[model samples]
Target: MSSPDATPGASSAIGSALYQLATRAVRRLPRDLSLTSAATLATLDKTGPRRVTDLAAHEGVTQPAMTVLVRALEESGLVERRGDVSDKRVTLVCLTEDGASYVRARRQAGVEAFQRLIDQLTEDEVRALAAALPALRRLDTLDGQKREGTRP
Candidate 1:
């Protein structure tokens, strides 16, 4: 029988490992942008133009906080404000061409760093990770669902 500490079902151990890995990965990112800014940029890139309120909700931030972030991004030419066609009073946030390129480059750098680390893993370990990728993606979907007040 395995010791309690050795149990594979230990949630705390899994959470700790996930946190450490995430922290290290973020540290490996380029110094050009803060993680929160990078995250906002990436989200805009992936989801196209969005309302400030919607973006704030998606990012789990208050509207005022997101407004501050959006202002900085706009000042840096990384985002632009456009009038919403259906609602002229509401402004939508979208990435400029330069913003898209910047986000792509930053993302590529992070991918390269991760790829280098993955190269050190054995073929079997790499395959194991590949197998787990789907489940990891599902976790993101599940989290989004939870945030949207939906049952996963």
Candidate 2:
């Protein structure tokens, strides 16, 4: 077996640890929201209103599936469809005030959940995670920049 300290093993170790943490964090999210709904809210919140096709692209779902999801969110009063200003033929999905509130609540819950998990970590582990934040965030930002084609 490759030693954990070996150069080739380092990235694998980090990736594995991050994957575990991510799965654990996701499990702690509020049970009420289905993954589809939560992700839809997050996408609209982040990118503002978008065409159904755009939302579907971002969520990696079929246009028909996104239509159904958006309809559900609309019925729940979390979102509304409006005519795109630039092109009246285009409809855009926009988050309602209730939707934004739901997003905030979900985000807060996730933070609290992560904190709870962190509480179980050793002090040294906590410090290590804290120290790693900068590099992690930098990498994340770079990734977003590449996708967005602009620095954030």
Q: Give the TM-score of each candidate.
A: 0.83, 0.83
Clash pairs of candidate 2?
A: none
- Scored by CA lDDT, what does every candidate get? 0.87, 0.87
Off by over 4 Å in 1: 1-10, 147-149
- lDDT of model 1, residue 106: 84
What does the lDDT read for residue 48 in candidate 1?
A: 92
Can you write out model 1's per-residue Cα lDDT over 1-152, one digit (the tens) per residue?
23577768656676687789889988878787777778889889988999889888888889998999999999999999999999899899999999999989988887888899999999999999999799779778987687656887
Off by over 4 Å in 2: 1-6, 142-152
